[model samples]
Target: MRPLRIAVCVKPVPDPKESNRLQIDPATKTLVRKGIPLVINPLDRHALEAGIKLKEEAEGKVTVFSMAPPAAEQTLTETLAMGADEAVLLSDLRFAGGDTLATARVLAAGLKKMGEWDLIICGAESFDGGTAQVGPQLAVLLGIPWLTRVCQLKREDDNHLLVTVEDETEQRDLLAQLPLLITVDSAVNQPRRLSLLGILAARKRKVITFTADDLPVDLAGIGLNGSPTQTRDLFTHESTKKVELLTGSPQQVAIQLLDKLGLTEKGAGQ
Candidate 1:
């Protein structure tokens, strides 16, 4: 059989450690990522790992794709260090402030340009957006079938796969054909750490970048203008705590607490 062709989609999100510092742009209603460090969306690492393992087993190459700003080139380089044979960055000012659908449109154009693939892998959701919409949307744009929240996957052959998916209620096993897309849950596998050799090898490879002009995308269907969902309001949540101490006998304190809580009447007999 010919080598398996796999494509993995990844995203660069703000570091979880510094999430508290993240802010929303009032003007654009988008994330204010400037000056913040970027990291691979945690679950996406698992997706990359799955693709790499499949490549190692099937004797194929894995390509990583991302739709992010030029700064995300570092994040893509990290994926190369993690075992992806090549990386592509879809960066353009016109691609900014996009919702999941708009983002999927850009990715679809990029994937079409990259040629055919046997499988595409992606994380179930992005850490920042927590919206599990891109994978399925991209599949729709590419005219392929897609599965999400996959916890286990095994190759039945070059053209078929057995997959298990889980949600809060139950797990279901399903068989999928090739030329497929799957959004894997974090439980699928543990992501491997970066090795010195892999890092060294990655430095020798260059990440290919594509702008809006490079792909066959309609200008009216990308970026902020293309997004159908609009944020009505954006703000940070504030929490406050209060404590009080009562001085009295056990019975008096209990009565005071009940009255303060407005439960005295309901618990009068009990």
Candidate 2:
């Protein structure tokens, strides 16, 4: 059997449950991360599981990659327990304030440094960004064909397999070849929980960390400075309900309702 080597890209996102504490930095237009707990992106778990499953069946290796803050190292630990043989974290202060494109560039560079792989897997999108652009952008940067929103993958042989991708209209079944990149949907599988035994085993597994200097990438295009999109404004919408009561004759209520809605004839008649 050929030695199958798979690489899965994962991201760390702030725990969505703690969104109440979330804040944005006006100067940077980036989320304020301090004091907020972090967790692995929900959808990325499915991607990791896909790689792990393939590794188990193929008796190969599953390695994970990420471009995140150093704090995300803890988040990657949980992923190691989930079954990756090892992990590579591309963390650096210079990599901060990146948009999706910059992030994809960083990830692609890191993965390139890790050498060759038979398969590259990623989550369809991240919960925090929700742009779902990284997977495809990374594919383009690496010059690989990618299938997004993949729901199921059944390996037919060592290199070929039957894949089910969920499109907006319908599901597509295709025979995919090796050396392919795929972004898996969250519904692909029920992610397995991290057990005590797995955690113990992860202690022995390796976790390699890298910085932009460690990879071959243009310094001008790997961070916020390298990002093209700029946020002009960032603010939260207040959804608190404002209630008003009108109790009077039908005519009076009608007038009041119209006035509240600015539909009164006063301005129109003028």
Candidate 3:
């Protein structure tokens, strides 16, 4: 049996639990990201969990990779604590404000530099962007077959896997070949929690940090300048809900509903 080499893509996002603290920058048109703690994108954790489990089954190596700012090293540290064999952080000032395509390009370059691997895994989408674009884009850049929204996966053999991809309306099972990319959803598995022992173990493992110059990346295909998408606007909608309990007979309730909706001659606030 051959060892399976798996690479998982991860993203650092503002702790969703603290989303109230998140604000948009009026001048830069970016997230006013500061003071807020960071955590791995929820779905990406599932991706990492999938790779870790596969490595355990095949006696393989699982590497974690991310394109983020220097501060995101903390996020990668968390992944190492969760059992990733090796972790790589691709950080460069020029890589900031990159769109999904640009981000994928840098990651693809990193993978190329790392040489051949048997499998690649990523989250179906990120909680912040929710674009679900990076995984498929990486597949296209690497010219490999890919599966998305995979909630179930089983090793059929060293070279093949049985995978199930699901959505609200569709679910399909298929056999996948090696050197394939997959984006997993939360339905795949519950990501294991970080343990004290794992944290202690992670201290011995140093994360690899690379700048844009370190990889064979085209300077023209990176950074905010390389991103084609432009932000039109950033705003949050304010939603207010008013609950009113109407206690009346069937006929009276119908009248009340109509009145509240301003459908009657003597409408609401009458």
Cα error, residue 32 of model 3, in Å, equals 1.7
Candidate 2 weakest ten by summed lDDT: 261-270
In model 3, the worst 10-residue window by lDDT is 261-270
* Best candidate, TM-score: 3
Off by over 4 Å in 3: 240-249, 255-270
Question: Model 3: per-residue lDDT, tens digit, 1-270?
Answer: 588989999999989999889999887778876998889999999999999998888799889999998989999999999999889999999998789999999999998888788999999999889999999999999999999999999888979989999988999999999989999989999999999999998998878999998998999888889998978888887878878899889878878898778787664334
TM-score of each: 0.88, 0.86, 0.91
Q: Which ranges of candidate 2 are over 4 A from the true structure?
A: 239-270
Q: Which pairs clash in the backbone of model 1?
A: none
Clashing pairs in 2: none
Kindly list the per-residue Cα lDDT of model 1 for residues 216-263, writing each as its tens digit: 899899998999986678777676667889769987798878989899
Question: How many clashes show up in model 2?
Answer: 0
Q: TM-score for candidate 1, please give it.
A: 0.88
Instruction: List clashing residue pairs in candidate 3.
Output: none
